[model samples]
Target: MTETAIAEHGLIGDLQTSALVGTDGSIDWYCCPRFDSPSVFGALLDEHRGGRFRVCPTGTAYTTRQMYYPDSAVLITRFHAEQGVGEVVDFMPPAGEIATGRHRLVRMLRCVRGRMSFGIEVAPRFDYGRRAHTTDVTESGAVFSAGQLALTLHTVREPEDERLARVRVEDGDMRAGLDLVAGQVRGMILESGADGPPREVRVADFQRLFDETVRYWRSWLARCTYLGRWRQVVARSAITLKLMTYAPTGGLVAAPTMALPEQVGGERNWDYRYTWVRDASFSVYALLALGFSGEAERFGVWLGDRIRERAGGAGGPLNIMYRVDGSTDLKEEILDHWSGYRGSRPVRLGNGAAAQLQLDIYGEALDSVFVGDRAGLEIPYRGWLAIREVLDWLAERWDQPEEGIWETRGGRRPFTYGRLMSWVALDRGIRLAMAHGRPAPLERWTRERDAIYEQVMRQGWNEDRQAFVQHYHTEVLDAALLRMPTVGFVAPRDPRWLSTLDAMDAELVTDSLVYRYNPEASPDGLRGQEGTFSLCTFAYISALARAGRLEHARQVFEKMLTYANHVGLYSEEIALTGEQIGNFPQAFTHLSLIDAALTLDDALDGPTGPATGR
Candidate 1:
């Protein structure tokens, strides 16, 4: 509830689940074995009842800085005091492919300079902080016991008298005085003894693990094919997105942590830990364009598998979002007991909107699916069947109104963008069938696509604004509609698209930051204001680049890149004051940035050289 929302950190899960680390070096939020499972450290929602594992500096006059390693998921946080500076390196190795529940979070602490004191606090609140637990420390490590949860901490530093003395004292030097000039690696060990599948950690085992993690990340970075102007910035954002991915299912989440509100003191916070079908499609382009097709291909297979499981004869399609493991059981609830980030009350876990009738996802689905299978990747016949079944379902209901892209609670209007994407889904479906000689109802799909296109062109246009409107009647321009060119709904050079771009520039483009839509002009059923939608801001650059407005696009793209954090990470939205609002390290923002940069590069090189796909 402070000015800065402290204690809100994210965990790097292998896909089964994830953890959230607070600035206090505490794992304040973690749901084991799955992203949407009940919390282990629900302190993010209930500080008193939630479980947390923490390591803190004992000194009072301490300052901290957090950054990820260049082009890697390894996040290193540095703590500096008058005496010395210590760094905690947090990462999950992505090599050798371990099982889901067998995942590990490596927390390495070492003094960077001078001498410093450190303290360790282990509090494990299991089952959303509901179960009682106990703690024990052996010569090997320290273990915490809860109802069905077992957490063990391992390190090279032994339990010395001075180390235990740090518990009561506010400030003092640690037992190990790190020599800054000549670095030393002392062995520390932790063991898990409480229950479950027991595992032991020996200090000697850390060397191989550390080497594997660094090697894994470097190997992954070697796949990047971008040789463009913003290669460094683009690659950093790509690494950030990869870090946010859940490896087990290949289902990349929208973001890492939740309840970080769009407005610091407002109630616009939402949970983003789960995977959305919409995000998968955008990630297809982002991941593929960066020369990382293996992960993208795997994601396509994962999504197809989900469809095979859930595409039951296709009357009404699947839910909008699901657990990282593909479970559709997210039940949203507000945590009234805990005040929210920056006093933004009603801290919530889970998402109710997952069950909302967002008809727009059908379009977002095909956006990624079409591209994923376009360039030599084979989509199964069942996958093709699932795609057709959904489109057929859309043909009958394309005229209906439902929740639009913004997930607005103010009720759905005839959102122009939603209608536009429906057109995309049908169009792409037809194109895919024609390209591969697959069976399809081309007449029906083309009829529906053109029908929707005609209706959108005729009624969605606002004559007064000289641009396409948000819905049928209103003149409010939506930043999402700026993506019309990229989605293939309209050609970039089309006059209508140009006019809409100009209209957005005149209206939504406030210093190159794009608001999702004017909140005042259209109420989204929440109070307070939010920053410019970061996704839309990047989409602006993409739109410009696609239209051959390279000079302007480059300038806008560079400026947007500057808004990224110290380590070149982005979130869903950006506040007016340049703070990253919404979820941290959002996939949507990164994907759009990749899209824009790729387009700019293609523009300069004319597609004959290194870059093959546009």
Candidate 2:
């Protein structure tokens, strides 16, 4: 059996949920109904235990290539062999509440030229493959069942190329694809329906749904605000992030699937399929800044709800992260039954990091709230109170040590970036209070902010190293500090900060990719070596541009773009060997890219690249 890893796949979603489509034309991971839903396609975890749906050209000699439609979310995969070329374009429409059946993964194929052969393997293991599945094939495709979960796939005509690959039975070649003709209708139930979801779909019915999916996506893109040199790349990344968003609650999962290792056969693997308060906050600025306030506003609403719910709790602020639907009951567990991705052991399902105190998220959460408030995204009066309440709570608890931004398993320490962002939380709150004339503890907040600033400068900096260390008294450098200027904490060119920047360049820069911190220097409580952080690399570009090193920064930014996967997607980290590490198409990385690109464009065009209305 051919094996596929999660990070090796490209993600395509319809804004409500997403699926991991492997390079070889198999969907290895996906969740139905929502981003945090149980796996309907779990092949990424254990190719043997977890199931998958694949359509591939016959012949081991066949080479595979893939790309996304320019400026759109449609993904096309081509298989080339001596016999001929076969292609598959996979996608789902982005409209809400369509035909609404069990979620679908529509595949279409086309013979590019001479006769070719292909195969289809529709084996689905529901509920993380803890149960057995029964497959029922019909005229269209097949319906897969295991327990209460049901996932039905729809295909057309006689799919005779068993395993979806075989040359002998073909007159021409396998020619099919998820409809992308702009008017094809496509939608899925995502939940088991009456009679346990229809076993298959009619060809005409599938065609209509496919057309609808295309129209839905096109209409949504019409509202995109990006018009940059990398417009197609940026817009598609934006859409990918949006598609991964769970619509009902406005929560965006960090990534669509779980257990995609950060390193090949390494223990750096962890699940990323949940809403991160920090990531959501950053996403607002990215979307709103790029003229997609619709997305930002949606996220803002979700954040507000979360803030309100958490305010009503004993902690008086919030949990660091939550399930897409705001469930705070994520208990991390290992699926010992299935082998991990790439033989990386301890495949985690729910994230234990949730229980860790990542204080940085409070500031991040408030950052978006502040921005959304300014951009006229309305907050309920009570919701506004909740936001202020969190700020007030932060005013007191900001100095506490917790898990740093990397969500390290290491014992919590005083992360300087966490402190820097705490300052941002207070700064923005103070501004909101003063500007809106809202009742607030401004005097206390200002004093607190000033005191925090004084403390950060005094201890957070290591005079000998001439750089702000990751923690007080430690000589470690952290890439998270690359946001020092972006968050308005300090001038990029301050002599001391400049010295710090130089120190970071010397200590942390590896071929222009920035490491979060030298793991060798600061053990993050994990054993495996990590890759250069993509987010930090982009931040380095932003920092360089801020320091007026535009040529160097622009070069770095351009080169960083080279690291993106073929579909213009990026994971959280880029391995030293150029493999994407961490989660596939991380939102934080893409947003930072947007920030870096915008900053560089401003340096080049004097803030006149393209105006995305506030």
Tens digits of per-residue lDDT, candidate 2, 444-522, equal 9999999999999999988889889899848999988887877778777779889989999999998899988988888
Assess the local accuracy of residue 4 in candidate 1 as a C-alpha lDDT between 0 and 100.
Answer: 30
Candidate 2 positional error at 384, Å: 2.2
- The TM-score measured for candidate 2 stands at 0.90
Position 558, candidate 1: lDDT: 80
lDDT of each: 0.70, 0.74
Q: Could you tell me the lDDT of residue 430 within candidate 2?
A: 88
- By TM-score, the best candidate is 2
lDDT of 1 at 87: 69
CA displacement after TM-score superposition, residue 442 of candidate 2 (Å): 1.5
